[model samples]
Target chain A: MAVDKKFVGKTWPTMVYEVGKEKVKEFAKAIKSNNPYYLNDEFASQSKYKTIVAPPTFAVVFGAKLIEPIFMDKELNLNVAMLVHGEQEFEFYTMVKAGDILYSNTRIIGIEHKEKLDVVAIEIMTKNQYNQDVSKGIYTFVVRK
Target chain B: MKAMYEKNSIDAGDTFNAQQKIDKYRAIYYAGASGDFNPIHIDAEFGKMVGLGGAILQGLCTLGFTADAVTTWIGDPGRLKKIKCRFSLPVKIGDTITIEGLVTEVHEDTGTVVIKVINQNGGDVLTNVQAEVVTK
Candidate 1:
């Protein structure tokens, strides 16, 4: 069955995630990155950003928090077992630093039913405590029947 | 050391390669870091039950590697302006992913890099991988 096209514009409560310095370091380590911008405090303190900053793909860490609600929503009824990530995109604006409170909003942007699979897309827009755009991520998934 | 792009002058044909040996615990650590605890990524039995063979690595984790290759080469994380890719294969434990990046185009003030991500078997793991950075 095809995902309801009517859910295209459906949205959930906006999620607020606080970027933590240690959490950033943990994520950096998981990706096997030892970038000073993400780890070294004194080195990053001397850099242009003036402090530890999250990696470019760190957007996914915050973005993942919002994705869970969508995947678990009974109304959407996503086939969790058969769904696989199809594609991902990220456009970085202002780098996210520790101690920044980010507000993220995600919505169902598209739901297309193809011959072999159903493709669902959700776009997430995030901004910081300063209301500056942090980054935008579009996560696409393929649900095989 | 981190601002090498500003020093090296990134141009067309410039290339760099980064390799990662995906350890068995990669997914568990990734799940803790990224909040993706899907069974297909962490539970081997569940993953096999679902026909994934065994616990597979998260697609985002693989993309993280792809982005890291570019930022590592460019030397400035903020200089990486854009990145996108499609997950073409399931990366499992013990797989070695090789990320090869080529500066395919350089415009007046920006450089475009085309990336090829492949597993040890030479199978495409992620396709259409690309990133763009500020050059000016």
Candidate 2:
């Protein structure tokens, strides 16, 4: 079945994620990034953020939470078996620091139905504890027909 | 925001390069951290069953590596304001990818650098990758 175009404007409930210092370090190491801004607390404390800041791509960690619901959404009835990540775009605004509580909301922004596949794009917007916009991500998935 | 480049140091046509090795267990660690438990990334048999040959690295992990390339060049993670990329090929374990970026445009008024990431393999792995950073 093709992805329903009606779901294009649908949105998921807001989810909250609390950034952890160790988690940031773990993520940095996983990506082979030894940057002190994301790893060494001592170095980060003296840096501008004054605390360990997550690497820029760490936005995916929080963004994934909202994305999971979309994949699991029964109404959408997505064919997970035929889906693959097609592209990703991220815009970082404020630095995401350790211990910052982030609120994420996802909405279906685009749906392109092709003869052989369907491309679904979900836009996720995250804000910090102060309600300052932290990051925005557009996750595009290609679902084969 | 602090400046990543000198007032007159940056201009269009500047370039930088970075490379990363995809370790054997990179996918497992990434799955643990990112909560992406996709079998195609962690389960070798599952991947082969699905025609992937073997377990493949997560696309986001590869993107993370690309992001590292940009941040390392700029010398600050905070200065990296935006990044986008299209996953053109599957990144298998032990594949060494080199990320090269060229400064295509420099906004003098905003003090931002626009960069395009290209694969050294004739654009086989990652394509249409680009990033923007605030020099200020």
Candidate 3:
């Protein structure tokens, strides 16, 4: 079944994620990144940010929480077995640092049904504890029929 | 060294590259860190049953590698303002991924880089990759 177009404007509940220093390091190591801004505390402290900043792709960590719920949504009934991430796009307004609390809100931005598959795009906007915009991620998934 | 894009010296056709080895434990570590516990990425038998041959690496992890290449070239995490990619192929555990960024356009305040992520077999894993960074 194709994903219903009515859910195109649907929204999900807000989720809050606390960035951890160790997790930031773990993510960097997982990606095999040796950048000091994410790993070396001394190097990061002396830098302009004066703190260890999470990598650009770290947005996905928090963004995933919002994304998962959409897949599990009974109304949407996403076919998990046939779904694959088609593409991803992110626009960062500011870099997030360790210990910062981020609030994420996701909504369905676009839904299209092609001949063999259906594509759904979710836009997630993350904000800092101070209400400053951190990053915007557009996650697109293709569900094959 | 500061991770600032040298606006004056860099122009279209400038390039930077980085290579990462996807070790055996890569998928496990990435699954734990990213909270993506999909069986297709963690279970070899399940992957084979699903026709993926064996457990495949997470697409997001590959994207992470691509982002690492970009930030490594710029030398600062904050300098990267935007990045996107299409997951074109399945990256296995032993594959060596290489990311190459070509400066396609440069303006007063920003530069656009066209990135290509390829595997050890010269397969394009992430195609149509583009990144926008702050140069000013």
Candidate 4:
């Protein structure tokens, strides 16, 4: 099924995600990042940030979760098996830390059809529970027929 | 240079190193775990056909790694408020990605930190990256 171009500007309802310390460490270990700043509070305190900081890419996990419901909608007819991540861009408003409750609102930015493929772009604007914008990410996915 | 601290906390930029390597198997694992089966990431022939020298790592995988970098720095994954990045180049196998970050801004009122990443090869940048995290 072809994706509807009219849905390009649709914004999904906001979803909330909670940050966890263990999960962050697991992700860091999986990626083999041994940066002491992520592991030792003492070392982090010596740096300019003072508090422990998260790695830059950690948003994918939470952001992706927020977008999952949209793709699962039956009306979309998205072929999950034939989907490929084409590109991703993140614009940051602030650094993320553990214990913050994140709220994300996703929107479909663009849709283009190329022969047998449908290219869809989704933009997610995430904020803390306090309602301050923290980051915005644009992700492109290609769905092949 | 005097070391700067943020409210007795470490800044994300100060914890990152200028050198790191992305292993081939790690790329494969990321592809599997993330369900991103791009041919250019798993098939050398397909990669070459598409103009890449060989199988390249998925851009999302690198992004995921960057997320890991942020979570590790904060000491708790739960404190993450947001993260954002951009991909400038294809990361091939054996490419040593030197992740670096610079604190562009720190908001004390909101407790947010902004940073960027660069893939370095012999001191030359391969990719340009940026992200932000809100601390606890």
Fnat of candidate 1:
0.79
Candidate 1 lDDT tens digits, A1-145 = 7778899999888899999999999999999996788889988897888889999999999898898888899999998777888999999999999889999999999999999899999999999999999899999999997
* DockQ, structure candidate 1: 0.79
Q: Is candidate 2 or candidate 3 better by lDDT?
A: 3
lDDT for each residue of candidate 3 in B3-98, tens digit (9 for 90 to 100): 342233446787999888888889999988888889998898999999999989999999998888878877777878999999999998788989
On the 0 to 100 scale, the lDDT of residue B28 in model 4 is: 69
TM-score of each predicted structure versus truth:
0.96, 0.93, 0.96, 0.62
- Candidate 3's error at B77, in angstroms? 1.1
User: What clash count does candidate 2 reach?
Assistant: 0
Once fitted onto the true fold, the runs of candidate 4 whose alpha carbons sit more than 4 angstroms away are A45-50, B1-58, B64-136
lDDT of 1 at A82: 75
Q: Could you report the DockQ of all the candidates, in the order they appear?
A: 0.79, 0.62, 0.79, 0.19
Error of 4 at A3 (Å): 1.2
Minimal lDDT window, size 10, model 4 chain A? A21-30
Clashing pairs in 1: none
Q: Order the candidates by lDDT, highest first.
A: 1, 3, 2, 4
What does candidate 2's lDDT look like per residue over B7-108, in tens digits? 334457777777777788999999988988899999989999999999998999988988887777776788788888888888887777877777777785
Residue runs of model 1 more than 4 Å from their true location after superposition: B1-8
Give the candidates in order of DockQ, highest first.
1, 3, 2, 4
lDDT of 4 by residue, B38-106 (tens): 678888888888778889887777666665555555544444555544456677788877665555656
For model 4 chain B, where is the 10-residue window of minimal lDDT?
B1-10
Model 3 spans with C-alpha error above 4 angstroms: B1-9
TM-score of chain B of each: 0.94, 0.83, 0.90, 0.75
iRMS, candidate 2, in Å: value is: 2.8
